[model samples]
Target: MANTSADDLLRTARELFAVDGYQATSIGHIAEAAGLSKSAVLYHYASKEALLDAVLAPAEAGLAAVLHRFPQASDGNRAEFVEPFVDFLLAHRLEASIFINQGQSLHGIPVIDRANQLVQQLAHAVSSEFGSIADRVRFGVALGGAAYILAAQENWADPDDEPERDDEVRAALVDVVATLLTTTSTGIAATRGD
Candidate 1:
């Protein structure tokens, strides 16, 4: 049941961090939310930052796993990475929201810095595959749009507990991002000069 307690603390921490803002959230708040004593929260996480780290660790690993497929992307197998990318974003919405909403202000924090690095790496990996600046822009738009959509939802106080909703959103996001990645530049992106 130790795993269950840790999971509860992580979940509570994530929701509180997203809803209350990370700086405003305290270890006590997480403990109270998880229906545990402060010492119990401490048993799982030495500090609020440790709790944040736990919440973000899976997302970091997930993004890294997605990045590992970038070589396949260069070989015209970009489709192989799209679903995993979306799945990572959907699975780590709260962590993404922390970066989206609080990253700049939280600079110098190791986890946030590492998260930013992963995002930059993702951009470089995606952009390096295509020649045109326009393709790079498409990559940026697709990534930015997907991240924004997932992160924005965390602002809602209501928890994301709906599997059907998750499935629908996940499918739509995968389709949209996959289509964007695959489509040839035919719009302003095509015509614009580098």
Candidate 2:
């Protein structure tokens, strides 16, 4: 019973945070959505921040794992990293939405800060290999774009109703991101006459 209620609180909090933004959401809102008393929600999470922390913990760990797999800038192909990163975003869409979209507003909170740090690590690892500003921007657009696209899907697509759509989206995102990140710099320089 305790575990089930706690799970409910976490799920409700994540959905609310993703859709409504963390700053706009309140404990009362979470309690009402979870169909529990406000005190019951507090009993499991202690505070709104605590609830956010709980909801974000799995995502934090997942990001850390992704970072661990590719800790530093690589001289090899980026497809290896891009695939897992996209997988991470897909696996944790709600959590990714909350952190990626709401991160700037939610700074100073330790959990958010920790997640932000991991994101920085990832950016550095992936972008450092590209010396040109264009390649780096490509890196940002490809990764950030994929994250944003996945986050935006929550607004309209019900995952339960379109279960296979995720798989299709995942394949296309991986291909597009990898292609964007791997585009030849010479082509860009030629076009720019650099």
Candidate 3:
């Protein structure tokens, strides 16, 4: 290909890896898909793994941004803590395929580690309103399920297109999380004289 940018290569690589499985997607395949030579792809990314990293960078950044906002978002404004994250995960469903198809393959990678850490951060954010063990467990399950379902849910359209149930899913997700937080807050108040 002529004058293909690194981002163009990353977009092509994400498509290939999403459709072809990361294990099956080779540098050559990505190059051909991008209309570039294998060497051209290599010039920008040292390896297929590096290309995968580049492709997944946005998802990582999105989660990190959400984590950054956790401290400032109050319990009552739970949507402030959850909607951006739901949107982030939904937008990056293709990247989630790597986790679906290659679980252990990415175990020790920093990206995976950071994702786990973000999950913990989410747990902490949602649980910040209540100190009870039950509330912690409940919020952890609620937030974790919200993230997982968006990332792994069945796509009802072309893989390249956004999921058709965007508003439905977003509303249901926020509703569930709000219910969890409200229930926990009410319980804490009833029990602790708040």
Kindly list the per-residue Cα lDDT of model 1 for residues 65-156, writing each as its tens digit: 88886644643667667888888888888787786557778888789899888888876765555677777777877887777777665445
For 140-191, candidate 2 gives per-residue lDDT tens digits of: 6886677778877655667668544788999999999878876747666788
User: Sorted by lDDT, highest first, which candidate order results?
Assistant: 2, 1, 3
Clashes of each: 0, 0, 0
Q: Distance (Å) between predicted and true CA of 176, model 3?
A: 4.1
For model 3, where is the 10-residue window of minimal lDDT? Answer: 96-105
lDDT of candidate 1? 0.78
Clashes of 3: 0
Error of 2 at 10 (Å): 0.8
Error of 2 at 37 (Å): 1.0
Q: Rank the candidates by TM-score, best first.
A: 2, 1, 3
List the lowest-lDDT window of 10 residues for candidate 2: 155-164
Q: After superposing candidate 2 on the true structure, give the runs of residues whose Cα lies further than 4 Å from its correct spot.
A: 73-75, 131-133, 154-164, 184-187, 191-194
Return the TM-score for each candidate structure: 0.76, 0.87, 0.65
Candidate with maximal lDDT: 2
Per-residue accuracy of model 3 over 1-194 as CA lDDT, tens digit each = 44447668888887777667777889999888887899998887888877877887787777778778776556566667667766766777666555434444667766665666665676666666677777876776675566556645664346886765788887887778777755675676788998
Clashing pairs in 2: none
Query: Which wins on lDDT, candidate 1 or candidate 2?
Result: 2
